[model samples]
Target: MDKSNHVEINGDRFVHRLKELTDAEKQCLESQNMRIIPKLKAAKLEKDAKRHWDIFYKRNETKFFRDRHWTTREFQELINFDPDERIFYLELGCGVGNMIFPLVEEGFSNFYFYACDFSPRAVEFVKRNKLYDDNRMKAFCADLTTDDLFDSVTENSVDLASLIFVLSAIDPTHWSHVATVAYKALKPGGMLLFRDYGRYDMAQLRFKAGHKISDNFYMRQDGTRSYYFTEEELLKLFMETGFEIIMNTYVQRRTVNFKEGIDVPRIFVQGKYRKPLEGKSISTCEG
Candidate 1:
């Protein structure tokens, strides 16, 4: 199929495509299309995300993402470190220290958290947070797509790193660069956890015609942008960059409204990749 062009799905064209498709394939396509409404809503969410930190901090400051109360449960379980060991945690695209603040307050000290984002607003927000301290937390603004993270983090020093819904916002072509940086920055056996939008996700099907900012990328009315990914594409990008997958799962979450009699399904691909220990083959384990 020609990915460059959009698929038109009016009544006649839809019926034609249905005739050509097998029953199972037709069902899948219908499922994907069912996400159009949610996708449109999510697209509108992009505007708020474009100058996300700026608008958020201006109005609410650090209180916006303060629900870091959930970070220890959601993020900490992925770390392979002992709480007593001095660990280095780096969050690429760490906007406003949402995860950092929660982790610190959870009493997980003896760790240095290096947080960075490309947005200056994000950097300032992190710096201004009450939990931020030079001794334990460091915040900076850097574009991970093209810049070198080594200037901010020592090579092979990080014990745990997270991408957390950040990479899908970047141009897909730059995913390899982001993976390369993560590979170089993590210590042997260190973990890289990722959570991002998956292909056929409601967000992808919501795009109206002519919304293309580039192939596989679209801008929502809200000014934030997102790219969708398949498991195959995501696995290939990380593995080719010298990391081995440990856990890769396509997570499906559905929100149901009884009053509206509608079900909103959201899909995300979450993966954990680890840098190989010296002399250890990258292929021996699976993510």
Candidate 2:
């Protein structure tokens, strides 16, 4: 048996239970025709996403998402960690330590944090933070699609992973690869927490005419890419790759623009999935 196949789950020998899906379920997944958007075709979209970040950070920098303290609340609620339960946590696309800083301040210091982002500027922002230290938190600059996270973490060792508002930024076609990589890195029974723009989000609708890069995916004027996902699509993607969802909810957030005197309605999909124990298949009841 491959050493990587054996994972430690809550201090126990974790094993893989890759169950065969029912024919009906397999057909349902196949009918959806999910695919990776090729990089060559997605080049413009990627460029657009990068441009959006450049402008966004230039103007707002650390103040952007940091002001929205609700993220910390959401993360705490999702993980529900005990005070003394030490765990290994990884934040994929962790920009500027906004989430990490708050997690530390809340006295949740029973874990190691590995944070990575594709942008050097973003990593630099995290590194410069006075609150960040090398002992408890390690920040790296790498693209999740191609970079190796195991260089910073042991294989099959992470307990929880967070992909908050990150996946939608990448080309939808690459998401499966990301999922596979994440699955390989996490321990059996480990959890994956995600929150991202759902299909028809206010931001997606805000795209100007000709901003349609692909179906249900768009490019912001600032060079950032986004994909709005449906609940069915999200469920099938993860479950197909071997995860059992614990919670999946579509949250509607209405942002009142006091400055513009308009209301912006946004929809976000949030989910928590757990890796199944060895020889035990996960139930797809929620899907």
Global lDDT scores for all candidate models: 0.69, 0.71
Scored by lDDT, the top model is 2
lDDT of 1 by residue, 203-272 (tens): 6666765455555566555455778766677778888887887766555555567999979766667678
Residue 42 in model 2: lDDT: 67
Give the worst 10-residue stretch by lDDT in candidate 2.
Answer: 11-20
Error of 2 at 231 (Å): 0.8
lDDT tens digits, residues 199-249, model 2?
Answer: 656565555544566777765655677788776777888888888877665
User: What residue pairs clash in candidate 1, if any at all?
Assistant: 46-222, 46-224, 47-222, 47-223, 47-224, 245-287, 246-287, 247-287, 248-287
Cα misplacement distance, residue 275 of candidate 1 (Å): 0.6
TM-score for all models, in order of appearance? 0.74, 0.78
Q: How high a TM-score does candidate 1 get?
A: 0.74
